[model samples]
Target chain A: MPAKELIRLSGLTKTYGQGDAAFQALKGIDLSINVGEFVAVMGHSGSGKSTLMNILGCLDTPTSGVYAYENIEVQKLETNQRSMLRRHALGFIFQGFNLLARTSALENVELPLLYRGLTRGKRHEMAEKALRSVGLPDKLRNKPSELSGGQQQRVAIARAIVTNPITLFADEPTGNLDSSTTHEVMTLLTQLNREKGITILMVTHEDDVASYADRVVCLSDGNILSDTLNNRKNNK
Target chain B: MTWNAFLIALREIRRNLTRAFLTVLGIIIGVASVITMVTLGDGTTKALQQQISSLGSNMLMIRPGMGFGPRSASAGIPNFTMDDVEAIREQIDNISAVAPVSSSQMGTIYMQEARSSSITGTTLEYFSINNWTLAEGRYFSSSEATSGAAVGVIGDTVRKELFNGEDPIGKKIRVGSSVIEVIGLLKAKGQVGMGDQDDCIMVPINTVQRRITGYTSMHNIGTICVSAVEGTDSDKLVADISSLMRQRRNLQPNQDNNFNVFDTRQIADTLSSSTKTMTTLLAAVAGVSLLVGGIGIMNIMLVSVTERTREIGIRLSIGALAREVLLQFLVEAITLSCIGGIVGILLALVICLGLSQLIDIPFAFNIQINMISFIFSATIGVLFGYAPARRASRLDPIDALRHE
Candidate 1:
């Protein structure tokens, strides 16, 4: 990769269970992700794609590997240090949106900023900016139950990016949305990547969802089967 | 992590209004009951002490006996004569007033109609020594006391019973076949430690000795009322009386005194100390209720921790520090207890005020007890709240998130 790399993993391995019953989730996988790269990881069930995403997001440590983020060795970080890294450098979007119900969208976005030690006024201001950037400025006062599926996902996205983290991790971000809303959300993500140069690493099972990314890496049986670049015209 | 989190936690408590109220009810009842009982006990003790002190601190009582020794039903002790009273007055240094009292169970008293009452015979100084005041007529003269005259004073209850609301002063009341004219009606003095003071008729000592009981000398001198001189040594006065009685009876140094000399002030001190000990015991029993309330808080908090596992996970995953989680839950528990304590204090005040009005004893509102109850309830919150808060904070985010 010519561009500056943001994540590099070498000899990454994850094993579960004991002795003879041990099953490896990720076996000796090596990968590099460059800055501002829009990558999608596609896999069948039990293919270790989720494990890779977890290691990439600093949520899990590889049992035997050297995982580096922007030249910093992530595997050696303490538990609190790993959490701090996740707080300062990573944003996450889950398939279920995972937004706390009965909470306003603004408050939902303010959650991450609250942990950053920002004052009330500054936290609210940053939350409003993030929600506005996600094109939901008018929905700040609305709760998760009051918003549509696509609007709720946008609030989740705003919450993810409120801390201005270095990389965005979306695990099946549009899996629960309708076909039309899926296209709408994908266009929004693509625009965020092109306009703001924010790195996007997404995991999805659907080929159509993976096609929205600039590059795709496919996995089967805990091994990367293919890595390809797309030449399609920009959809947005 | 920030004050906003605390504000949010407070708002959350406000949202669950019913749960919050129910959660604090235990602490409320606990604190209020403690305060009310303590206040009532203190008031009763204060009233008792005040009543005892009002009975004349300088007065001493000399009852017949060898200092309250074992009683002998077969043979009675020698009666105190008029000469014994004179000898004590002559020998004692701080003798202010001396009166010899004799009592008999002459059942019925009659003014116009007949009623039941006890009759007592005493000298003139009995009026001042026992805090008696005449309401309608004059007290008996010293001449009447010496010449064995039939003059008498009637108490308020006796007057009411025999006179039937009519004036009893200067009226002749027939007592046990002897007619004695009432010289004075005593002012309304309420009951003291013994019983109702207004249930007897007073006659001259010589008259009761000569006519009613028909004995040359008084046998049972119920009590010898002695008042100490102002600014003189009361202990020296008691010692002088003891020495003079020893000389009169020709007793050796190893022999016990033949009479009991009790200072009313000492009795007052003894009564107050006993009241204090009783009040403290009652307060300690009431304090157990507060402990039970604390245990209730702990039980409820532990259940809340178990119920909100997923919520804790969500907060933790969203970047909430373990300490922040710990503090949030702890504050919630404390808020519940503090609200309960405040309401309990208010309730206890109202109850104490009502009880004071209904009872004879005064109900004193003590601010120190109120503060202590509040602090105690808050301490209960902190102590009981710790385990649940720690459990919530120490939960594994991944495991908690996956909890169904």
Candidate 2:
């Protein structure tokens, strides 16, 4: 009920199996993310970070607990209803830069907008604008294979923000890039967050990657180890 | 949404054009063979029917014994004689003309050329019964018939073979030690009923019996061709001829009549129906290829779904509905088969044309068959395509994303 708590998770539990084979990935975790916040979740391997990210991104259901986005009950929404939420409210970028192969960059960026019922002309215009904003207007017709890794990830970024989603999820987005390219991508994300006021939630293991977020949430063995506002990274 | 799906389908096909073409090959061969068989069969039947119809619907051929077809013979039955022909011509009402016909597969004949051909012996009345119009010269004269004149008329093939386009109106040809002058040259009437009707020569029945073979029984003959005058009932004429033959053969009520009277129209009908049956059988056999082709499409689609699991995951994450993915794959299947159908139709056209010309029958394009094969292939796409498309749509997004 805080002034701008856009996402709230309370007593969230996600287990992998039944009986003796059961693996509880997240154990009664509670977290709140405010509007326009860039939050990075960091943890070691087997620390339940990916499971928690999956739940927060609405890509997976929790075994038990409450998940609400903007006060709407996400845990209770049906599959299609959840799909609708994802379509209208969320955008995702993957570690692999999940661009469709054999498709041009502009077409890849236009993919999300196609489901939003935009006219053909509007879809093209917005896709071109999104590509230009990501600094790839000249490479609009280049396929993923034709572009470098940094450029491909830029196309994926354009795809993510083209629909003007309420929240963006980046899963180890810079993990596949070189150190210099990673800096560029990180700069692009910070620029998008500062200029567009888009709430960003990223999952990463690197301290350098997490250093760009306004806040950091650290998990250890299915439980939150630390949650702290990062004065060093906060742009506002 | 469908338009977007269609575009996706088009892009997918274009991405792997070779695989798409191979996937549709079964349909192409299927439709091509089917159209070829059907078109040629119809052409042959058409040509036969036209030839028989030109022979006149009202004509009946009375032969020895009760026979269903040309080669079938009712054993122990006697052959016909000229007395039967004369009796029918004089006693039967509605009878316009009647002629006794005899034929022999004679040995090689020589004059200007040497060739062996069937020799038909009949009178000028044979012309009227068969409605055979002369192209040149004249028919049999009564004096020539009574005196057994050694004169003949050559059909187109015999003219080509022995005459070599030389005027056969007065030239002489030798037939197994007998010499005959070609007094009339018949016009080109192509193969009718059976083999080449133009290959054989026609002469007076008397000339054949007395001069050629020396079998001089005046009443004995071979086949009788009879025609009815206008305004006569077919059934009545058949009954009149049957009763007359029965009486002439001296068959009691318990005994079987030894002669056969056949309607030309009935033979034409039977021939065409049999051809229709053959066409249906051939088309059905070819239809199985279409089924296999559909299955090929489904198999490839299932493989495609597996191959693109992560791609599908990306689409789902990007907010594509399950049905949209389903529609996209379904469109691809339909597009594949429909293209195959179109190619099959074009291939069939070329094949049918070549075959019709090769077999010397008229090429008949049946629009109904074209429509049926086209729609049937399209339906095959939809029916076999749904299973794989549905499998793609029902894929779990999490698992799909995890799939390598």
What lDDT tens digits, residue by residue, belong to model 1 across residues A147-235? 99999999989998888777999888998999999988888888778888889999999888888899999988778898999664574
| DockQ, every prediction | 0.27, 0.48
True contacts kept of each: 0.18, 0.44
Residues B146-195, candidate 2, lDDT per residue (tens digit)? 78899988887887787666777887888767888888877776877577
Task: Determine the backbone clash count of candidate 2.
Answer: 1
lDDT for predicted candidate 1 compared with the true structure: 0.80
lDDT of each: 0.80, 0.82
The local lDDT score (0 to 100) that residue B190 gets in candidate 2 is 83
